[model samples]
Target: MKRQHSMPFGAEAVHGGGVRFRLWAPGVATITLQLDGDQELPMTAADGGWFELTVASAQAGSRYLFRLPDGLLVPDPVSRFNPDDIHGASEVVAPTAFDWSDGDWRGRPWHEAVIYELHLGSFTASGDFAGAIERLDYLVELGVTAIEIMPVADFPGRCNWGYDGVLPFAPDAAYGRPEDFKRLIDAAHQRGLMVLLDVVYNHFGPEGNYLHAYAPDFFNPRHATPWGAAINFDGEGSRVVRDFFVHNVLYWLEEFHLDGLRLDAIHAICDDSTPDIIEELAAAFKSVPGRARHVHMVLENERNQARYLTRDDFGRLLHGTAQWNDDIHHAFHVLATGESDGYYVDYAADPARLLGRCLTEGFAYQGEASTFAHGERRGEASAHLPPAAFINFLQNHDQIGNRAFGERLCHLASPLAMEAVTAVLLLAPQPPLLFMGEEFAAAQPFLFFCDFGPELAQAVTEGRRREFSRFARFADPAVRESIPDPNAPATFETCALDWSAIERAPHRAVLELHRQLLLLRHQWIVPRLAGMDNGDPRLAMPSARTLAITWRLGDGSLLALLANLGDDPVDATPPPGQLLFATANLDATTLARGRLPAWSVRWHLQPGDSR
Candidate 1:
């Protein structure tokens, strides 16, 4: 089947024989279309500062640019593909050209999602879409239901985390062409794996964004993000701006046949209008005619707004499908690593209690004041939300890559501690996410890497080191200077996963632990997740580091967890249920003795009521 998402802007191949090119250059009066560097066609000025031109000779693979009123030329803002990078000409892509074989793939349910987050550039040696496709069978064997790829939108230079993407519509040429991405998604669907793209709607990259030059109204100066002026979602000329991003969402999901999208750092998206941009986007996605397709909308909102994750009376999603639960990660990190720096301070004093809270309630800081935020209150009450509304993880891109050394949990925590947390994360009712190399405990660090122009490169590198200066470890100027330069080629190269490590000794053991935990989750937990009620579960802290939680599953069965995340054993009364899995070779006799081992986790399940 041929898949295509038709949008108002950008170049679209006409049926008769031609390509229609349109641009929204409200900041400029006149615009000229430059095709193949030789033919220059004057576009007709239409209402709302739009320029339109139709060329019968122009077809797919035609490279074109727009000449402003001045002598300057710029690539299409909504380009389908910029083969020569962001500063080059935009290539006309026939979206319907690629044939899809997964016509019956309606996507898996959210409850079944075991997301594996990976960066396309660092996921394999090829660092491209086709290379990622080769690893599909491995992911399936690892029991990952969805693969959440980092952003592939066109950005400046060769390598980036993709948050710097400027062209929301075009896949980065560094990761192969748009069709190659389609094949990757197609291949993943064939292997019964859902593909989710990480999209950045909050802000554009630091460079190569030409919107300000031709469409100044795209951003509002009234509000500013850490990057710069915020996107104009509520200001004058905001309608076009909102539509641009809304269409971009439909473009990826419809044209590429993606299963879902994870919006990046949505807290920075400043929208004050009624039924804000996020609401509108979710509504638009829900309105699409696909009852059988389980297309999810995930978010990374630091605000922890539970209202967006609300469901209908019948347990259908009212808006977003889920959110990345940072609270859970922070609590787990503090317990395992015991490093109370930065945001870890919030959970340091009583990490075990916070971890228990997160296991029962959706968030630990529900309507609570944040000491790290300087007394500013953070998060809404999330107890009413189901466990599926919160996606928990021990490590993710931001958690690992943001560190000065980019240390994974394996680098800091003991193997027993890591195994215990892994068991808790994977076997929990909430869907779990694994970073690229976490399953095998690959030694390579996921450093912060970028490739910008010389001028911006130096600034970015210096700024990156300066960010860690606030910490005591990097207090000395000499120590901070030793941090890897983000613009360095070695920095980017070192982040690539060493696939061979999975076959090695220590790495093989870690991989086995993850595989077994995921297997138990799929067999014993996922079946009881559907129709799970939303509310607080029974939670208790029997000791300083021992937590016991019992959740009533949808099947009316009671799933319980007894964890001791400490260096010493503690006295505890185990919850009543049959043991399903345990860490550190824990057994029923040891649990029946009312003594929980250090860094141990036990999962138990009681059969549902017959009535």
Candidate 2:
């Protein structure tokens, strides 16, 4: 089947022949279309500062750019592909060029999602889409239902975390062509894995964004983000700007056949209009015609806005499918690593209580003052939201890569502590996400890496080191100077996954543990998660570090968890049910006598009452 989303802007193939090229250059009076870097044609000016031209000879594979009135050349703002990086000419790609085989692929339900987040560059040796395709079977065997790829949007240089993407419509040439990306998605779908792309709608990259040169109204000076001026979602001329991003969402899902999107750091997207950009985007996705096709929308909002994850009376999603629950991660991190620095201070006081709340109520701080945020009120009550509305994880890209040394949980926590937490995370009702190499405890660190021009590279590297200066460990200037340079090739190389590590001793054992946990989750938990309610779980703190929680599952079964995450054994009564899984050396006699072992977790399932 041929899949393509017809968009208003950009170059589109005409019915009979030729390609129609259009550009929104409101900042400029006249715009010229430059094809193949030589053939220049003056485009007709239309209403609303639009320029249009039709070339009967121009077909697919045509490289083109726009020449401003003053002779400056810029690529198409909605470019489908930029072969020679961000500064080069845009390539006209026929969206229908790829023949899709997953026409019957309708996507998986949100409750069944076992997401594996990976960066294309660091995921494999080739650091390209084709390289990732080779590992599809491995992910399937790992029991992941979805693969969330870091942004592939065209950025300035060859190496990046993809958050710096400028071209929202084009896949980065560094990760292979647009066709190669389509192949990755197609291959993933063929293996029964839904592919979700991480999209950045908050701001453009630091360089190579030409929208300001041709359309200054694309940003609002009134609202400034950490990057720069916020997008013009509520200001004058925002209709076109909003449409540009709205079309981008459809473009990825429709043209590439993607199952969903994970919006990156949406807390930075500034918009004051009614039915804001986020709401409008959600409405657009919800309006998609196919009822059987499940297109999930995940968000990363630091504000912990529960309203975005709201559902209607019929349990139909009103906005986002889920949110990355940072509260749970912080609590779990503090509990395992016992590090009370930075944001960990919030959970350090009483991490066990916070964890118990997160297990039952979905969020730890519900309309509570945040000490980290200078006592500002944060988060809405999330207890009304289903557990599936929150995505839990022990480690993610930001958590690991943002650190100075990029240390994974395995690097900081004990093996027993890691194993205990892993069981809790995987077996829990909430869908769990695993970082690229977390399943096997790969030793390589996911360092912050980027490749920018010489001038910007120096600033970024210095800024990266300075960012950690606030921490006591990097207080000394000499210590801060030792931090890896983000622009260095060595920094990027160190982030790549060592696939061979899985064959080794400890790594093999970690991998096996993850595999077994996921297998049990699929067999014993997922089938009963369909109708699980939001406020169904009952939580209790049996001891300072011991938690006993019980949930009424969708299939009328009761799933229970009794965990002692501390270093010392705690007095606790095991919930009455059939024991499903437990930590190493756990005995029924010890549990019956009200003594739970250190760093131990037990899962039990009680059959529903047969009326």
Candidate 3:
């Protein structure tokens, strides 16, 4: 093993701006600036162990590299504009050059947001930022207020899931470069859409990750993650590591103008500090100058700890925003499809549980036994939160693609069942999220993809097969071959949205249902659902199989959602409100009578519409 120096990244980038440059070098003492190959500027060091350089007109397109004190060269640690490839020197980009037309765009609240998670490559046949731009109009019409893009940070090769990103500042060369991404965001904002970036701070990808070569202790040996050594959050020189990540957050917000960040897998972050790394990052973002609503943090944490969303403990939430609500997805999937295999064991086939989780408690597994994990987890109940505290989704990259084989909700159930699921997802109290191609029930699967070097790629391929073989019936290696070869171009190509699906019948029906649901939510729901009670909105679970939700609007117009999670249809009259929305077709007589179909969701407006 080779010894590497840790570069102090914080000392250089945080200097109150005159184009001060910073790069982390743990193993080296001296560093030089390689400005476009010829000009070498000496970098000074702060007493706290960091290298810094100040340059004029250090905006965008200024190509530069860092020469380690020992003679090795590397990219800038805080390169806001990586016009060069990740493995190459850094290129500067002026964050302020792009004309932003969204200064007046008021954000959609977390409670009201319908998030559509997408990948730039797989989102369209073009598989680039430009290609994704073509579909923004479709998303806007679909009723989504925010578009959560998968990681755009640069990685090795042309295709990846972005968790393995090594260059935090650069957009993948495969995604048509940096300005293309800006086009997408600017276009999104122009259409009244907020963009949430999916950020991976837990670990970097395997290939093209040279951070260790420059900063050895960037990862701590005391704690370990499944991928590799954990980041040094509380260890020696860990303050610099914290600053590195905090800088990344601010860079994305300040440079890309991204509205928010979805921090990937916070539970795996394993920092045992008093003011946890997450809290520190959150506090830093919250404290940034002129960041009112432009920057926010959303966590994808498996821990059912409400503190991830609550403001009660540690004030972590003063900076934190919301977490991905897996419990809601679990309960809804179990109830609708009756699939109780993996984590679904914690859930039962009950609409009431699903409704209750979203309406009142915000999670189905708060202080409950998890059969899949075979443990008693989630010991406390977090009921006193707002509806916006959770981000609900039927299919995310993990849920649909991480299964034994990538299988979507559309594949697991019938068309009607899909419609019912979509109804609940949209009409639920919390905000809803749609995975890429989900609006039309896309046939393509979002397989786990990576662009590691050959050995790592082989390891990932074999590992994916072996991992899924344990619980899955697909034991044959031939069957495992269907798991998309992540590095292959097809992996990215296959995931693109087949807009033609919208013209098909079942897909069109589902698409129409989504459109209608969005209309109903914006037109009738947002006005009624506001404020916090003891918990979130109270989900009225009526029985082992029925969920009832009533939203009393500000104008006294009650909106109620009723769903039958059972296999058998339940014939019951809805509460005395006119039937405004129903997953299944309800004749006027049936609407008046209120007979709900099996596994169906219905929305009813309270009587006295004028009120």
Q: Largest lDDT belongs to which candidate?
A: 2
Per-prediction count of colliding residue pairs? 0, 0, 21
- Comparing 1 with 3 on lDDT, the higher-scoring candidate is 1
lDDT tens digits by residue: candidate 2, 531-571: 77683788889888988999888888888999999999987
Q: Quote the positional error of residue 352 for candidate 1 in Å.
A: 1.0
lDDT values of the candidates?
0.91, 0.92, 0.72
Q: What's the C-alpha lDDT at position 334 in model 2?
A: 98
Superposed by TM-score, candidate 1 places the C-alpha of residue 3 at a distance from the truth, in angstroms, of 0.6
Residue 313 error, candidate 3, Å: 14
Candidate 2 minimal-lDDT segment of 10 residues: 283-292
lDDT of 1 by residue, 67-106 (tens): 9988789999899999999999999999888999999999
Ranking by lDDT: 2, 1, 3
TM-score for every candidate vs. truth?
Answer: 0.99, 0.99, 0.89
After TM-score superposition, the amount by which residue 555's alpha carbon in candidate 1 deviates from its true location, in angstroms, is: 0.7
Question: What is the clash tally of candidate 3?
Answer: 21
